[model samples]
Target: MSSVLLFFQGLEHSPLSVGLRASEWMYPLVNTLHILGIALLVGPILILDWRVLHRRATPPVAALATVLLPVARGGFGLAVVAGSLLFITRPLDYAFNTLFQIKLVCIGLALLNIALLHWSKAWGLAIKDNQFSQSVRLACGLSLVFWLLVLALGRLVGYR
Candidate 1:
């Protein structure tokens, strides 16, 4: 058999592939869950970042972070699970899709942005003082942009 067919055949025998194929509605269900998770994850992050940028009625940064971080983490977990299932349904296609690759890269950048915010002493001091500095503002803007890119790229996966 051709390599592509062999790869797909291998995927078909995997547990995730079997699960994805076992139910006609499974892929749709997983896709829905993935969307829900993305919404949950992005919504609070956007709101918090906007507050940081606009400086209007901003909550204490620590308080906002505390409130949103857990929710975002939960959503991340759900998204990962559902996304993995969705990917397993057509692993070869997903792996080769430009949109999917872009989405992955965007996700990595977003995660890196978050890590930088967490690790930066300036960010820590700003949060402690309830002030959003220029650096923090830039991070917030980049986070929003990258995440939106991720969302758009994720949607484009099906088309591409």
Candidate 2:
């Protein structure tokens, strides 16, 4: 057997994994937290994205970001931790699932989009001067698409 398979098998058989699977309420609670985490993460992002995309910039990008970014980070952290816990319950199955893999890729793309936006000169201009450049707008638009795809694929991962 491949070492990769062995690793997943080991994860499935670990004490925490076994306990979570065996528990009546623990898995459900964790699943609920995952949903809530996604809500928290995506809600802020969508709102911020919408503001950026809007023709009339009522609330400035920097103002919205200052309020939303921290909440998004908190949500992302919770989702990752909870998602990791859930993955261990059936590591082999999820590790091989196509939807799960796609979801991961979409998440990577979303993160990359965020990084590019933050690292670009346009981001600074948008925040400091209320100047929304083409690049910043494009990044925000792509962020909406990528994150929405990630959300959909995450749901589909279970159905597969």
Best by lDDT: 2
**Which candidate leads in TM-score?**
2
Ten contiguous residues minimizing lDDT sum, candidate 1:
53-62
- Residue 76 of model 1 has an lDDT of 83
Give a tens-digit lDDT track for model 2, residues 25-97: 9999999999888888999999998888885657887888999999999999999999999999999999999
Q: Write candidate 1's Cα lDDT for 1-160 as tens digits.
A: 7898788768867987888778889878898999999988998888788778887655787888889988988888899888888888888888778889889999999999999998999788977888777999999999999989988888888777
Kindly state the number of residue pairs that clash in model 1: 0
Reference-based lDDT, each prediction: 0.86, 0.91
Runs in model 1 with CA error above 4 Å?
1-9
Tell me how far candidate 1 lies from the true structure as C-alpha RMSD in angstroms. 2.3
